[model samples]
Target: MRRKARQQTKAENRPRFWGRHAVAAALDNPERRIVRMWLTREAAEFLVPPKDIPVTYAEAADLARLVPGDAPHQGAVAEVERLEDMLLADLLDQAEDGRPLLVLDQVTDPHNVGAILRSAAAFDALGIVTQDRHAPPESGALAKAASGALETVPWVRVVNLARALEEIAEAGFWRIGLTGDADTSLQEALGPKRVALVLGAEGEGMRQNTAAHCDALAKLPISGKMESLNVSNAAAIALYAARAAA
Candidate 1:
């Protein structure tokens, strides 16, 4: 009886994806193991699950109660198992396509990370790299912010970001760290080669050791009055620039 109770607790702790886009994307992802889904009648028509998947019809208030008090569930919610973490080497191994990869350094905010994932998917970047300890776990808030990009993009979490940067460098990617003080503009620094765009946290920016691993450092061409852009906005601009350059 104790073992069964523990199992039930573990199952409940698994991440729950909420909102229309987030739940729809999870259903679409072949790798996602959706335990169950709850949806209102209106959302049910918009997002049809596979024939084999179990679903429950619930009212908006019921869905709201299932998630965090403030979560915007958009009439749907899904209990899902976390995706397997990918190795840094596995991500680097597939670098033949010359796609730009985004690396985050201690950017702990779930919303920023999710927004970055959205931009990464938009630009068709290879994937996102984050430190295992510093990053947030997959959650409903993140999935909501990603707006379906969470399922589409592969997020790689590594033990040591600086060392991972070394591996990225070794993998033929020219790591470009974005900094406000950098002498070169992002446009001028980017070249016709595989690139890795490294961004740090909001206030402190990239750590010194992390910056040291990069091949070059550059800054966005923004107004001098502004100290720095939000991490997500910066990621979007960087991705757009990288894609445009490519």
Candidate 2:
């Protein structure tokens, strides 16, 4: 219980992010409030923080102590507050036609979520939606994996995923749930102008209720030898197909 409380506190407060890309992106994002930064002289040379932000120059060895084990900090580390909460309605209002929206159903792995965010940015996605309780909070590992995409993508966390899906449908998006058992191919389900690609966790896949919320269920065209793809890989493929279709 104490460990969980500590983790919750870390997520709520200023979390230290390392690696050049993550640190540089955070420094660039005007919405990001950097509490402090510790950087090697080389890292400090490139990452210029706001005039108000404090910076401490240190050696790479000293910087290693600030982040987790073998995190590849790349000589940069920044303690930053999380970005402000974003509303799903605001995202829907700003969404453009043909820009796919990626939705995660209980995808709790920070690495996978981060990779998905990178892919979302690559494909010019509108945004990503996830259940607040089921999603991983912003952290160093996730940010490093995203490689700066975390700052570029708009992420919205909702209280209830089903209700959020309902809202997405009302906003003119055709929700397609990706599952291995689905009979329809993603290509067959890709004719919609606005698409919301819903993916679930790897093994359990989407919840019954979550799948029910989608307009259709579709699967990737992987060979039968492979049973399933990682959720992040699946999201990238779905985004590509949706973009092509659009």
Candidate 3:
């Protein structure tokens, strides 16, 4: 109980956002509760804040102090409140336009997940689904990689990925698992249907159980010399293909 309380406290206090795009997006998001903002002179000029939010002007070194060591903050940092999590059912119910959803299976790399979010936003995906226990939390590295997409895209974290996939399947989406050994190409497998592209971790790929939940497994056409592409790269390609097909 004490450990859970401490974790809740930690999550509540850890809203430090950095980087120009990340900070700018947080400021722009109407739902985001801005605690305070620290900016270098150059970054300050570009940001116009509401009267209620506090602003602090500082030097580049000072801005860097707000983030981890060696982080590229781009002279902007903001401490804001975390956005509320979206329920799987709620997201599915609200998804009337049939936008594609990206499901990540135990892909813990923050940079990769962030890049996936960026691509999802570019392709106008409905949202991203991740297992809460296995996925990375909101952090500067993730926001930096995502650019501004972290603010625009919804990330739905669930307890069980396989169960979540089942829920997704029931929501009228065709779950397409991306695996290198699959018999069909992505384009051939995806035939103008609402889709949820499920991708797993870097090397291990999707778990056997997760694959079993998928309606179909498909692969991208790549050189035989390369066994697999990076998960983020694969996701971007899949999103583009889905968009083009739609």
Per-prediction TM-score: 0.95, 0.95, 0.93
Q: On residues 74-185, what C-alpha lDDT tens digit does candidate 2 reach at each position?
A: 9999998899999999999998888999999999999999999999999999999999999999999999989999999999999999999999999999999999898999
User: Relative to the unseen true structure, what is the C-alpha lDDT of residue 18 in candidate 2, on a scale of 0 to 100?
Assistant: 94
Tens digits of per-residue lDDT for model 3, 1-246: 999999789667776888889988988899888888888888878887787889898999988777899899888888877888889998898664447899999999999999999999999999999999999898888888999899999899999999999999888899999999899999998974689999999899999999999999999999989989999999999999998887
Reference-based lDDT, residue 168, model 1: 90
Q: What's the alpha carbon RMSD for model 1?
A: 1.5
> Where's the lowest-lDDT run of ten residues in candidate 1?
90-99
Candidate 2 lDDT score at position 76: 95
In order, the Cα lDDT scores of the candidates are: 0.92, 0.93, 0.90
lDDT of 2 at 4: 100
Model 1 scores a TM of 0.95
**Can you write out model 1's per-residue Cα lDDT over 1-246, one digit (the tens) per residue?**
999999999897899999989998999898899998999999998999987778999999999999999898989999999998899899888775458999999999999999999999999999999999999899999999999999998889999998999999888899999999999999999995799999999788999999999989999999979989999999999999988888
Candidate 3 — worst ten consecutive residues by lDDT sum? 90-99
Q: State which candidate has the highest lDDT.
A: 2
Full candidate order by lDDT, most accurate first: 2, 1, 3
